[model samples]
Target: MTRQKATLIGFSAILLWALLALMTIGSAPVPPFLLNALCFGIGGVIGLVWIGFGAGFGVLRQISWKVYAFGTIGLFGYHALYFTAFRIAPFAETGLIAYLWPLFIVLFSGLLPGERLRALHVIGALVAFVGAGLIVMGRGDAAGAVPVLGLSLAFLCALSWAGYSVLSRRLGDVPTESVVVYCLLTAALSVPAHLLWEVTVWPQGGWGWLSVVGLGLGPVGLAFFTWDIGMKKGDIQLLGVASYAAPLLSTLALIAAGLAEAKPILLLAALMITGGAALAARASLKP
Candidate 1:
């Protein structure tokens, strides 16, 4: 794919993620655990199927099993840690905290040999941090504020996600398609655990099952393929920068859901954060 096409895909991936978050506000009765697993597991399998169809599983033969293994573990950690946060915190708080991965990546991507974050990277990261905090705090919904436990776990989710992204890049010659498919394999582990927890501690209805299936097809399956295709074809930083759009899209979702009133102050904070992120993204054009 061309660079321009990759950029469009990158933006599309973030918007898709935003869409999933939006859907969550209206998501049906599936236990969150069961819902998460079905969605993500189905997503990865579809991606791998697509890969197999295109290359007859021959391309997957090129992937390092070790890398795929680590990716599965990383993905397992990422989603489970993230979903757990929702048990103890509000969506806005958990979502904001989980997105701290960009800063974590900025700090660690240098260790991966081929990727590095320079001074402007540091500045951009710091600015982005402030912006993210502002966006979360701007809501003034103290009830939705991140609690101590939720904050810790949410950042853990962020770290796991960061680790997954950086480590996947370090696979050197592993096909990106294979790595992505493998990450979904992690969800296979997650779903059983989720089902166990649901049967023991929570209950779900048929509507919930339907919602989970919808999520599996739309957000999990389609979204990951879009993201993997984009990442393989362009700069990772560009994709990361584009992800800042999630908060904005999510906030718009909140408004539509009538869960929160839209405020001018919140809108400006969104502007500052996304604007700064865009400016920082521009620095990449130079070299």
Candidate 2:
């Protein structure tokens, strides 16, 4: 695909991720690892059905086991660390730290072989980060003593995702189809982890099950595929800067669902994130 088209596809992942919190709430009482297992399993099944209808399972065999390993580690490790961090730290603090991935992605994209990192990209990333931080911190949770280990894990969670995204550029030749393997392997891994750490609790009802399906179809499933395409062929820096919009959009989704209250700060965050994305887009447009 053309760079512009790929970037737009990647941006779709961010849009889909905006429903993550709301969907997770709807799927509630299901523990994190079990939820991961369910969503990734559903995502994997979707991929399998997709492949069966079009390219067939032959395409999967062509991908290297190394690629599968990398993708699985990226998907599973990120969720594992994120869940662990929140379990140990205050939700607001852990979440704010975890949201640093976008900033990290923007910074790290400069190191990619053909990419140029302009000043505006950094400034834009920082501006967007501030907006995301406002949303995370505005959750009104009381702050307690800092949990160093949890904070460290949260930082690593950011790093893990940023590294995965940027490194995927180097593997540009890999088919997005390989993400199917990644999802399946991640689900497999989550199954054992859930058995070890969490009690199994299925979705409570039709709404709960629908929420799980929604997550698999959108945020957890298709998002990775589109993001891979974007990282491999799209404007990575622009996508990185634009990723900050996920949190803002997610909060809005929550408010619309009546899971969260609409706040004045969200309006300010909207402006800041918009301006930051505009700056990044301008930078990318420079000849």
Candidate 3:
């Protein structure tokens, strides 16, 4: 696909990701780990159906366990932390914090072979960090203040995903079908965690079921595939800038769900973060 098409696809994935925070809001009928298990389980099935059993199994057999380990830690680890963060903190706050991956991506991307770390990249990373600091510290009202643990985990989610994106690029020739393995591994990991730590209550009703299904089919499942394709084929700088839009979209989703109110600080944070990320990626943003 052309870079433009790839970018559009990636942006669409961002929208689905925005919806994730809204979908998995309350806890009881489905705990964090259990939600993850269900989402990844259904996602894995979707992947399996898409690739068919024979071809999918062939790819799996060819890949090393090392690959699976990395994929699991990246994909599953990010989601687990993310879901838990939602449970502890306001979804909008946690999401903005987790959305730091775009900035981290710009920083980490320089580590790859043939990619040089530029001065603007450093300056921009610092600027973005400052923006994140503002977000973390800018809770002028007690109603929206995020807990320390939730804040920390959200940042960890960013770090985990940034590492994942860079590593994914480094791992040459891994097929898009690799998501199937990641989803399956995540499900396997999540099952034990859910059984041990969480009470296994199924989604309460149609709304709950819809959330699980939407997560699986949209963000957890198809979004991964589209993102992989975009990262491989799209304009890097463009995608970097585009990624910042996720926090805004996610925050908007929260507002629409009546789960959050629009805060001026969030807009300022968005500007700072997006501008900083854009600065970091300026070298590649050229047409």
Candidate 4:
């Protein structure tokens, strides 16, 4: 695909992720690892059906085991760290730290072979981060003693995802189909983790089940596939800057769902994020 088309496709992942908070709330009472297992299991099945219809199972065999390993570590490790961090730390602070991945992606992409680190990219990323920070901090509960370990893990969570995304550019040759193995392996890993750490609890109702399906089908499933395409072939830096929009959009989704109150700060965040993305887009388009 053309770079523009690939970038647009990657941006779709952000759109789907916007629904993550809303869907997760709807799927409530399911513990994190159990929820991880269910969603990734559904995501894996979706990948299986996709491959079965188009590329056939044979395509999977052509992929290297290392690629599968990398994908699994990226998907599973990031979530594992995130869940653990939240378990230990206050949600808002931990989430703010974890959400640093986009900025990290922007910074790390500069290290990739063909990518350049432009001033505007950094500036735009910072601006967008401020917007995302406002949203996260605004939603935060009253402050308490800092949980150092949790904050550290949350930082690692950012690094894990940023590293995964940037490195995907290096493994550009790997087929997106390989994410299926990643999802399945992640699901397998989550099962044992759940068994050890969490009690079993399924979705409580049809709405809950539908929400789980929604997550598997979109945010946790196809988002990865499209993201691979974006990282491999699209404007990675632009996508990095644009990713900050996820928090803003996610908040809007929550408000629309009546889970959160609409706030005046969202307006400023919208402007900052929009301006930041515009700056990044300008930089990307320059000759």
Candidate 5:
């Protein structure tokens, strides 16, 4: 795919992820690990079905086990940590924290060959981080206190995702079909994780099941496939800038679902983030 097309595909994942915060509502009592296990497990099955057992299966063998191991850790670790944070803190707050990944990606890109960190990139990161601070401080959850552990885990989620995306660039040559392998690995680890730390509670009710299905098909399943292709072939800088939209869109989704209230502070935060993203994309906007 051309860089523009690939970047557009990557941006689509951002929009899909926006729905996740809303979907995660009422999924409670169910452990994060269990939820992720089912979501990614079903997603893996769908992937296998899409690729079939022919050339797709053949592609798996060519992938290095190292890629499988690290990729699964990055993807699954982010999900598990993100879900855990939601259980501990408000989804809106945690969502903002988790979005640090894009900034992380922009910074990490500097480490890659041929990618330089410009002055504007540093300013953008600072601006976006300031926006994140506003959102976190603006939360009014029961005395306005954000759990330290929850916030930490959310930041870890961002770091994990950054690692995953950067690693994807390194292994960009890997077949996209190999994502099934990554998903399977995630499912396998989740089994033990669920048994060890969480009470197994399947999603209940129609909305619950719908959320699960949506998550599997959207974020967990197809989004990953598209993202792999995009990260591999798209303009990485542009993708990083575009990812700033996810948290804003997710917060909006939450409000639309009545899971959160729309606030002026939220709009201000969005403006800051958008400005930072724009600055970061300034040079690459046409690329």
Candidate 6:
């Protein structure tokens, strides 16, 4: 299909997996680091399956080292910081701040070569930000600075994520698989470090390890693979607009998992974000 279609599909998959992640499969009875490593490692393996079946090894070799290095490291940094925030702060607070990556895209898009982000982008960003605010506030979790450590790390996660969004475009010709490889490789690098310092590391128990596996294979791995591949097939502008669908879907997933209480206010916010993102997507498509 077309690149825009692929992007839309990819982003939709991201939402699906994000929902899975927020759902909590068995129970989180492990440390964040161990669980993160397990997830990344498993996710990496699943990504390899994509390479093996569809993309191929030659594609992997053809990808730029720069893309591989930056993408891998960038992803690694994002997860590390993000999970750290979870350890230190409340989930709602960390998640809300972390969602700021969409806005980060707007700020960084200008510096990107050929992506002069039109006025519509600015408006869309504001709309999405508003939606994020509703999700954060609607859940009864205000943006407080009480969890100093977790909040600070959460802030770092947002910054890192923003940098990744801006920088990934530089890998224009690199295979999306290569970026996936970078992530897997980064995960591989962490295993050794984890084996050393930590005690009851993330994967402390079977269920905890399963949680890691789910995160890696579904959200982090499979979700990204499809999303990037889809984006590669679609218009970047349209893809950008569709990306907002992830958070909205994620909220729905949260409600199903009992993490989110169904309230008229939050539902309204989700609708607004959805509408705003749809409009923004259309704006990018029109002359």
* Tens digit of per-residue lDDT, candidate 2, span 1-287: 79999999999998887776567667877788888889999999999998989888899889999999999999999877876675566444455466667667766776777667788877877786676566555655533345778878877987899999999998999988999999999999999899998988888999999998998899899999899999999988679768876656665666777765556865566556556655665665476
Tens digits of lDDT, candidate 6, 1-287: 66646666667655654554363333355555565567777777777777789968788777667667777777777777776666666554455556555455544555566545567666766776676566556545554536667656765776786677656555555567775686677777667656775566344477555666667767666766665665355455555555556546666666776766667866666666565656555555565
Off-target runs (Cα >4 Å) in candidate 2 are 83-97, 116-141, 145-155, 263-287
Better of 2 and 6 by TM-score: 2
Which pairs clash in the backbone of model 2?
A: none
Tens digit of per-residue lDDT, candidate 3, span 1-287: 57799778867777778777777773335888998888999899988988885565677788888988888888889999988888887667788888888888888877777677788888888877887787777776763555989989999999998888767776647777887889998998999999999888888778888888888888888888788766766655577777877777877778887888777887677677778888888854532
For candidate 4, the per-residue lDDT at 210 reads: 96
**True-vs-predicted CA distance for residue 138, candidate 6, Å:** 8.2
Residue-level lDDT of model 1, residues 240-279, one tens digit each, is: 6777676677667767877555667556655555555555
TM-score of each: 0.79, 0.83, 0.90, 0.83, 0.92, 0.76
Which of candidates 1 and 4 reaches a greater lDDT?
4
Shift of residue 77 alpha carbon in model 4, Å: 1.6
Error of 5 at 230 (Å): 0.1
Whole-model lDDT for model 5 versus the true structure? 0.80
lDDT of each: 0.63, 0.78, 0.80, 0.78, 0.80, 0.62
The 10 consecutive residues of candidate 4 with the worst lDDT sum are 135-144
- lDDT measured at residue 153 in model 6 versus the true structure, 0 to 100: 75
Better of 3 and 5 by TM-score: 5
Model 2 TM-score?
0.83
Model 5: colliding residue pairs? none
Backbone clashes, candidate 4 = 0
RMSD of 3: 2.4
* RMSD score of candidate 6 (Å): 3.8
